[model samples]
Target: MEDEHKELYIKEKFNNIDYMMLKSITDCIYEAVCVIDEYGIVIVWNKSAEKLYNIAYEKIIGQNIEDFFDDAMVNNVRKTGVSIENKCHCPLKNHPVLANSMPLYIRNVFRGAVSTDRDFEELSRLYSELENANSKLIFLENQVKKNLGIFGNIIGKSSSIVKKIDMARQIAPTNSSVMITGESGTGKEVFAKGIHELSGRKGLFVPVNCSAIPSELFESEFFGYCSGAFTGANRKGKIGIFELANEGTVFLDEIGDMPLSMQAKLLRVLQEREIIRVGGEKSIKLNLRVISATNKSLQEMVKTNKFREDLYYRLNVVEINLPPLRDRKEDIPLFIDHFIKEFSEKNSKNIIKIHGEVMNILNQYKWPGNIRELMNVIEHIVVTNKNGIIQKNSIPEYILLHMKENEFFKEYPLDLTRAIRELEIENIKKALKITKNNKSKAAKLLNIPRGTLYHKIDEYKIKKL
Candidate 1:
C-alpha cells in the first residue's frame, strides 16, 4: 500500500511541458490555489497561495501539505476521489474564506488533488457591522422602555440609513453647519440630537421649531430681550435659544418657514457668530453649532424669493438628505420590531406580531407621513389590542380605506370587481388557516362584516381545511 501510494505521487512529477503549463495556469488564477500529490507533498503553489498563507513559494512547493494547511478536504478527496466545494470554516479571521478541493486524476489514475480559496473579507466586515447595529438597536429598545426622553440611537443598517449615519458621524467633530432635508416626521430632530451627542458638545441641544414660533415673537425667541423691553415680557428678561445654546448647538427646525425679516437677522448671527438682544445694543458673542432642517426646499424657495440664497448656502455647508421610509423598505422590519417592543413595554402588554395582511399592507404603503406615522400606528395597535395580537381591524379606518382604494392587484389583467373578489377569496382562505379554521374568529381577524363574510364564503366555496 505504501509503495503504491509512493508510486502515485512519484509518477505525477511535472515534466518540462507540464511545469510551464501548470505555472501559467496558476499564475492567471485570481484565487489562491495549491495542488498536493496523493502522498501529501505540495506540487504546485501559486502566487495567490503564497500571499494568502504568508509563505514563500520556494519553501512551500516541495514541502508536505501537513506543514501548513491541516484541513481534511485534501485528504478526503485523495482517498475517495470526490470533491468538496464552498466549505466555510468556523471562527473565521479578518479574511473569512470559502474553500474548494477536487481530486485530480491523470489517465484514470488517482494522482493528486487541487484546492482553491475565495476571500470573504468585505462580506465579513459588512455582516459584523450589521450585527453590532442590531445589538445596539435592542439595547436602545430596552432603554426606551425605561424612559422616553433619551433618544440618541439611530437604529438601522440599510444602505440608505448607513450612508446618512456615516455622514453624521464624520461631520460631528467638525463645527460646520449641517442642513438635514427630508419630509416631515422623518426623524430630523432625532438625527440633530444624535449629531449633538456625538459632537462632544457640553452645552444643551436647543431645538427651535421656526414654524411654531409666531412671526411677531421670532426676534425675542431667537435673541433675548432686556427686562421691560415690552409689556408682558419676563421681569428679568430671558436669553434667546441661540445664546442659551451657546457652546452647544441650536437646531433650527423648519428653517424655510422663518420669515424674510427673521432670515436676515439669522443670517447675520450665523455670519458674525453674535446676537443682539431685541431691545439691548450690546452684542453677545455666540459659540454655537447650528444644525438646521427643513421639509421645504430652500433652493426652490430662493428662486421664488421666499428664502435667502446666501443663508441657504451658509446653512448647507454640509447637507444630509435623509431618504424617506419608503425608499428604504429593508429597514421597515427593524423599525416595526423596535416600535412594537417599545410600545408593548410602554403599555405593559405582551402584544406582538401585526397581522400578516396588515403587515403586507404596511410594507406596501408609501408612508407619506414617515417614521412618526409608523410609530403612531404601532402605539395604537399596542394600546388597542388587549388580545395580544394586532388584527387587521386594529388598523385605523382611514388607512384601511386607502388600502382598499389602492387595491393590491390594480395592475392585473382582471377588472377591479374581479380582482377584489379574488383577493377576498385568497384572504378568506389565509385568515381561516391562520385562525386554525375558526370561521367566526377568522372573519373577525379579517375585519369583514360577518354577514358579508358568510356570503363570500358561500360564493367562493372556501372550506376550513
Candidate 2:
C-alpha cells in the first residue's frame, strides 16, 4: 500500500503540470529546437522548428533526417562529429536556409544528430545593401579629393601657361603670400583659384575686391566688429572676410587700389599673423594664405607715396606675371577650337569647320581684351554661323572695321572705308543665305539681337545670296 501511494503522488504532480503551457513556451522561442534518435531519425520537433522549415512537426518526427537533405551533408556531419553550419537551398520548398547540425553523444556512444535552420535570404539582401553603400562612399571620397586639387578646371597645353601652372603647383603646398600681376583680362584670378584648390586648407576662398569696397566699411569688413560697434551694426556680431578666410586663401583683387590706412592694417596682419576687431580690443590669431592680384604698377604707386612700400615688399615674395594674349597669339587657334566645341555642344549646333580665310582674319586681329574677349567672340560666331562652317563674312563688323582702321592695313594699300562697306555687305548676304530667306533665322545667325540685324539689313539694302 505504501509503494502504490508513493507512485500515485508522483503521477498526480505530473498530471497537474500543463502540457499546453510547455508547448506554448517552446513555440514562442526564436530558435528552432529538435531532437533525433540513434538512427538519424527525427524524434521531437517543436512548433518553432515546424514553422521555420514549413514542414509539420507530426510529419517530420519519426522521419529520417536525410529525407530533407542530401546524403553528402549527413556523411560530412557524421565524419567530423562537429557542428556544421552551412547555407542550403531547398528547391522543393522554394526557399533558402542557414542550417546548423550537431551530433548527439550518449556515454561515449554515437547517437544520431539534431539540426536547426534559419532564413538566409533576408541576411543576404542586407549584406548586398551594405556593400552598395560602401561603394558609394568610396566614390564620394575620390570626387572630394579631385575637387580639392590644383588641376580642377585649368585645362591647357600652352608651354608658357603650363610652366606658370607648374610653378604655382610647387608653391601651393606652402603657406606663403602670392602676388599675381598681369594685364586687365589675363586670368590672374584663375591662378589664385588654383592655389586655393591645391592648398590642403579646410576653409573656402574669400575674394574681396579692394577697389569695389567702400572706404567707410574697410575696417569692419576686414576685421570683424562686435554688436553695436557702429550705427548699423547687426544684433549679433559679424565675422570679417579675413576671419572667414582663416585656414584658407583670401584673394585681394585690385589690391593696388587699397586705401593707405587699410594698407597699414593689412601689413600688420601679415607681419603679426593676428587681427583685432574694428571695435574690440582682443587680438585673434589667423592662419591664411594671401593671394593678391592687380593690373596696376605697384612699384609706381610706391614711388608716388600712394601705396605703402612696406606692404608692397611683403606681398611681392612670390610673384607670377601672366603673359598678354597678343604675346601668345599661337594659342588663339587652340582657344578658338576649344570654345567652338564647347558652345556648339551647349547649343546643339553642328558647326564643324572654319574657312581658312576666316581663321587668318581671326589670327591677324590684335586681341586687346585678351582671352575674355576672345571667348566672347567665339561664342558669337558659333551661335551665328549656321552654315556648319565659319566663313570670313560671319566675322563681326566691329572687328572688320577695327582691322580696316589699323595703320598696318594702310601700309598694305587696303582702302579702309571701302573695305569696311564691302565686308558689311558681304556679312549681310551670308546671314540671309544661312537663314534660308527667313528674316528671323538670318537675324539670329548675325548675332545682332534680331532687331539690330534687321535694321542693318534694311540699311545696307542686302538681298539673298
Candidate 3:
C-alpha cells in the first residue's frame, strides 16, 4: 500500500504544472533551496540558491551540480540516500551555511535530494565586528592607563573648562574670596578643591556645607564655641571649620543657603580676619582662603533683599561661574571615559569600551544632573555589565526613552541589502501616502519601473490603502 501511494505521489509531482508550482514556492522561501537528481543533475534552483552559489538556474539546471559545488550536500544525499539535518558547512568559499538535505525516494528507489541552506554571512560579520571592537577596546584601555594619571580629577578639554582652569590657577595664590556658581551636580565642590590645591596653602582644606548646618549652630560651627557656651558644648572647647582650616582654605558649600543672621557674622569674620570664641573673651586670629559655592543667583537674592548685599560683594570678589554640562557638551566624552574607568575599577569589572550606540545616546542626552548624574549612570552600567564591552541593552531604561525615536536605528547595519530594503519600504510607504495609493504615480515619483514597483509591493508585503 505504501509503495503504491509513493508511486502515485511521484506521478503527481512530475506533472509540469505541479513542478512549476513547487519551483515558485521554493523561490518564495527565505532559505536557499535546491534539488538534484540521482545522476547529480541540477533539477531545480530557487533565487536564494542562485544567490548563495552565485549561479543562475538558467545555466545550472540540466547541468551536473557537482561541477559547480564541491562536496555538495544535495549530491551526497542523492548518492548515499542519507539525510543531513542542521549541519554547518561552507558550500561556497568563506560563506558558512547551515544546511538540511533529505533524499527523495520513489517506489523503493533513490531519485533525488532536496536541500535548504541558510547563509551565516550576517553571523560571521557580527563575529568580525566583535573582534574589531575588542582591538579598539584594548587601545582605549592602554590610553586610559597612560592618560588617566596626567589629567587629574577635572577631565574636560572644552574652551570653557580651559578658561576656568586658567582663571582658577591665576587666582589661586591670591587671598581673594572666590564664589563658584553653577547648577547642582556641576562639580562646584570639585572646582573649589582644585582651587584650594593650587593656592599653596599648608593647612587642611576644610569643606563645610552651610545648608546642612542648623541656624542656631552657625556661629559655633564657623567659630569654636567655649567649653560652657551651650549645654551640648564639649568641656575641652572644640575648634570650628575656620580654626581647623587656618593657614589653608575653607570651602563653604551652598553658601547661598546661609541665614541672614549668620551672614552678618560671616561678613564681620571675613573683614576682621579674626574670630572670637563664643562665651570666651580671647580673639583667634585666622589665616585662610575662603572659597564659597552655590547654585543660586546671589545677585538676584541681593535685589530681592534675601541675601545681604555686603556679604554678596565680599564673596563675589572673584566669582567663577562653572558652565552646565549641556553648555559644554564637547567635554562629555572625556567625562564618560574618566567615569567609566573609575567605576569599572571600583566595581572590579574589566570594561574596555562602550558601544558606539551607547556613546551616541550619552552624548545626545541633556545630562540634567550634570557630571554627578553621569558618574552615577556609568557606575550603574559598569556594575550591571558582565562583559568587557558595554552593549546597548545595558543602558538604563529612562535614558533610552529620553532619546529621539529615530536615533536608535542610526547604528550601521550588518546586512546592507536588508538596510536598503527597509529604506525602500519606508520611501514606498511615504510615496504611496503622497500619491494617495496611485501605483502609477508612486512608481513615477520613485523613478522605478511600474512592473518592478508592483513586484516589490507584493514582495515586501506592503498593504494597499
Q: Name the top lDDT candidate.
A: 3
User: Which tens-of-lDDT digit does each residue in 1-465 have in candidate 1?
Assistant: 254554454345753345657778897898888888888887777888777767887776666777765654665677687898887642123445677889988678777898887666544446635643454456457646755333238877889989999999999999999999999978888899899989998876777789899878988988878768899997656667787688989899999998999899889889999888877877888899999999998899999999999999999999999999999898787788888888788679897456777777678878889988988887887888878888878888878778666654233435888888877887898788888988788879999877877898889988756
Residue pairs whose backbone atoms clash in candidate 2: none
Candidates by TM-score, descending order: 1, 3, 2
Once model 1 is optimally superposed onto the true structure by TM-score, how far is the C-alpha of residue 7 displaced, in angstroms?
A: 99
Each candidate's TM vs. the true structure? 0.57, 0.54, 0.56
Clash count list over all predictions: 0, 0, 0
> Which of candidates 1 and 2 reaches a greater TM-score?
1
Each prediction's whole-model lDDT (CA): 0.79, 0.75, 0.81
lDDT of 3 by residue, 131-161 (tens): 4345345644764665423335776889998
List clashing residue pairs in candidate 1: none
lDDT for residue 431 in candidate 2, whole number 0-100: 68
* Residue 188's lDDT in candidate 1: 89
Native-to-model Cα distance after best TM-score fit, residue 387 in candidate 3, in Å: 1.8
Off by over 4 Å in 3: 1-151, 404-465
